[model samples]
Target: MHKRVHYAFTVKRNQKNLHHQLATLPRAKASVKFSDRTDTHGRLETRVVQAPAVSDLGVDFPHATQVAKIIRHRTQRKNGKRSRETVYAITDLTSRQASPEHIAKIARSQWTIQNRLHFVRPTAFAEDASKVRTGHGPDNMAALRSFAVNQLRATGRTNIAAGLRAMSYEPFRRPLDLLCLT
Candidate 1:
């Protein structure tokens, strides 16, 4: 017997979409529940997740075993701006295999990694605005940026922008020290 594959996807907000239908389901029908709130990066965020068995909707999503709805509320400390968003998702894992809490954790972890690496690379390194599209220029630049990020992280510099600034004045010294080179 082959083990079935599992998948998770957000449902779009459309009148005829499955996500809309599932989102309208009663809260009492949810099989799993998870909620968390945290203050980080000058912002406070609250997340609530509900997962329900998708056996009844199996015909619509053959391999889906659970559907999840996540509501996020965020407030910026600096500006006091607040925003709320809702997301719907389907996963192939059953409620027994993956609880709402586990799924929420996974989602948050993925976002953290993405924000750390991908978001940083683009914003801090100005990668998206780079005109280095010829030959290996882009790849080489990416590698160099990755190396810089790793070096900064290894040297106990949590803020890449500040690390880059510090290294800019003494590029040779910092890289040499980071590489253990005299």
Candidate 2:
């Protein structure tokens, strides 16, 4: 935000008041609505995103410009199981800056971010088991782990756990080559 960058993120049910406020927004007045379907992981998924006309709502957030509702319907092709989910979101960008399509893309990109960065952190580095409870210790360690992850990624290592294991097998040689230290 300080960098003049805009952001759109989901408002989960944990934020009861905000979630309820967005949930009940009148869809009839939506400024833009977009829907898309795709097949992934043996499941056919559909997403419908609607952003209502910009209005001053009672939400206690800053720089908030638009609120949106995302309804997702998923069907597993293998088992015929089905599921539905509704999610709300807030964005600092106006409708002009972020169309419904862009907002929906942002929402979907979050899952990729979680899988590529967040999920690998704990799985590759044992971050959750670390005892770095002090103020700066945890933050610094996280930065180091992120650096390592990025370095491995730069070397085209998609499976970070396997990359870490392979790097360890060669001791300082493989890692030094990646760092251009050899």
Candidate 3:
């Protein structure tokens, strides 16, 4: 089984304040401990009266004290029961001032098959109804399907399962040709 870690954080103006909050919070409490405890508590006291807001990328976060809530939820099964919990927190920090391009890449990378790809694979290719759960058979077949789907997409096939069908049923239109087979 694979581990699904859910990370939720916010962007804000006060970095030190955010760090302190992370230290005091539950899940992140142990993960992040302030090296300089003295300064962590006094961040609000030392703040400039009229500090300007921090703006990065296309968003402008206000200058006032902000609480960034970060929750990292890890789910696991124990004693034949699924256990779930969330850590609530407040902070004013962002891990990175991500570039617009970087944010887009992150968003794209978070895509899950259940939300987009899996249904198409099951509905279009009958992958779900597959009863082949033998040694290496299921794994190999899945790998081939994944490869075929990726190839089809790379070669401009709009629908994934259709590409699988074409690759599986048609010898002349095999992906190996587009795969650079001489």
Query: In candidate 1, what residue range of length 10 has the lowest lDDT sum?
Result: 8-17
The clash count of every prediction, one per candidate, is 0, 0, 2
- Residue by residue across 55-97, what tens digits does model 1's lDDT show? 8754376687787889999999999999998877777888988
lDDT of 3 at 160: 75
Rank candidates by lDDT, best first.
2, 1, 3
What digit string (tens of lDDT, one per residue) describes model 2 on residues 26-104?
6777857999999989999999999875555555567888888999999999999999999987998888888888899
How much is 178 displaced in model 2, in angstroms? 2.4
Candidate 2 ranges with C-alpha deviation above 4 Å: 1-3
For candidate 3, report its TM-score: 0.39
Give all TM-scores, in the order shown.
0.61, 0.85, 0.39
Top candidate, metric TM-score: 2
- Predicted structure with the largest lDDT when compared to the true one: 2
Q: Residue 166 of candidate 2: its Cα lDDT?
A: 90
The regions of model 3 sitting more than 4 angstroms off are: 1-108, 112-116, 165-169
| Regions more than 4 Å wrong, model 1 | 1-29, 39-44, 53-65, 75-81, 89-93, 134-140, 169-177, 180-182
Pairs of residues at least 3 apart in sequence or in different chains that clash in candidate 2: none
